[model samples]
Target: MTAYAVAHLRPAARLDDEVFEYMERIQSTFAPYGGAFLVHGTTPEVLEGQWPGGLVVIGFPTLHDARDWYESKAYQEIAPLRTRHLAGDVILVDGVAPGYDASLTAARMREAQEA
Candidate 1:
């Protein structure tokens, strides 16, 4: 299953040098752990409630891969930068692959639980 890391980030009270530095350092670390950016820019149109920040979505091959990257030392080293300057909700999601069916997914989950 494909896993995605989705974050909704609100910029700090003010952007500073530290924030920019963090951005440079953090983005560099993703590729090493099999992470690729699906969305890494501003949202031009607001479809719903007022969200006054940015959204980032990173794609990973599996949930494990996404977890590994987030927990990795490299990410840890720079994690504070973003947290210090932004606030957001981050989530890991497992996606259905091609030809996926609800019953098949349920069965797979059952098999894993049984094991």
Candidate 2:
């Protein structure tokens, strides 16, 4: 089953550029774990609740893969920079259920349409 990590970032003062730079480096480190950057910094207009200023979503092959990438020494080295930038709103959420079968879901939708 695939796993995902969704991060919400609210930058602290004087940390935007540094954090952005660090994130680039982080992406490089995640390559070996079959991680893909799904969304990076998509601004939200609907600011309901205590919304973070920025968002990042990453997809990994599995939950263990995601965890391994995070715990890896390479990521740990650069993680502090991300922490320093955000006012501590960074979160890693796992994707619910096993393997997202979007194609099957789409096919079902098409079948319904044909019906």
lDDT of 2 by residue, 1-115 (tens): 7688777777765667777779679888888999999988678676567665777788998888888898999989998877765754444556767666989989999999999
Worst 10 residues of 2 by lDDT: 85-94
What residue runs in model 1 are displaced by over 4 Å at the alpha carbon?
101-115
Q: How accurate is candidate 1 locally (lDDT)?
A: 0.85
Residues 1-115 of candidate 1 have per-residue lDDT tens digits of 8899999888876787777887888767878877898988767479877978888999998999999989989988888887877788899888888897899879999999999
Error of 2 at 15 (Å): 3.2
Which residue pairs of candidate 1 clash? none
Top of the candidates by TM-score: 1
Task: Please give the TM-score that candidate 1 achieves against the real structure.
Answer: 0.79
**Maximum-lDDT candidate:** 1
Q: Which ten residues in a row have the lowest lDDT in candidate 1?
A: 40-49
lDDT of each candidate versus the true structure? 0.85, 0.79
